[model samples]
Target: MNRVEIDGDRCKACGLCIDACNKHLLTLSSDLNAKGYHPIEIHDVEECSACALCGVICPEGSLAVYKEIKPKKGG
Candidate 1:
């Protein structure tokens, strides 16, 4: 399954990833991290397309997008 892994402790809560998400799946969490910042969270991971826009926009490099690769048949 395609997913985005977030390093909340490293996040600076800049909101760039939130704005960059085309599906608006990313949002600032209500809870604060060790750095006392509201890190970003995925509202619905199932909706994520692994487009990597959020990861690309994040200045802190906190987001990592992973897309599953299935082997082709009849190889």
Candidate 2:
């Protein structure tokens, strides 16, 4: 499973992260940040693939993702 984390303080609300997500997993928040910019949000967590493109595109480094590491079975 993949999870999304957003750094509210660091986000610039540039919408770059929202544009980078091809899966349409991200959205712009209705509320504005302290800088008066709409923060990024994820509407559908299931659609996310943990690609990390949003985090890479974000200049403010406000986004991050963590994918589950499956365990290997031992004989």
Best by TM-score: 1
> How do the residues 2-41 of candidate 1 rate in per-residue lDDT, one tens digit apiece?
8899999999999999889899999999999999999999
Model 1 residue pairs with clashes: none
Error of 1 at 27 (Å): 0.5
Which stretches of candidate 1 lie above 4 Å from their native place? 71-75
Evaluate residue 46 in candidate 2 and report its C-alpha lDDT on the 0 to 100 scale. 73
Residues 1-75 of candidate 2: C-alpha lDDT, one tens digit per residue: 689999776777788888899998888888878887788888778778888999999999888898877688892
For residue 64, model 2's alpha carbon misses the true position, in angstroms, by 1.0
Q: Mind sharing the TM-score for model 2?
A: 0.84
Poorest stretch of ten by lDDT in candidate 1: 40-49
Can you give the TM-score per candidate against the true fold?
0.89, 0.84
Q: Spell out the clash pairs found in candidate 2.
A: none
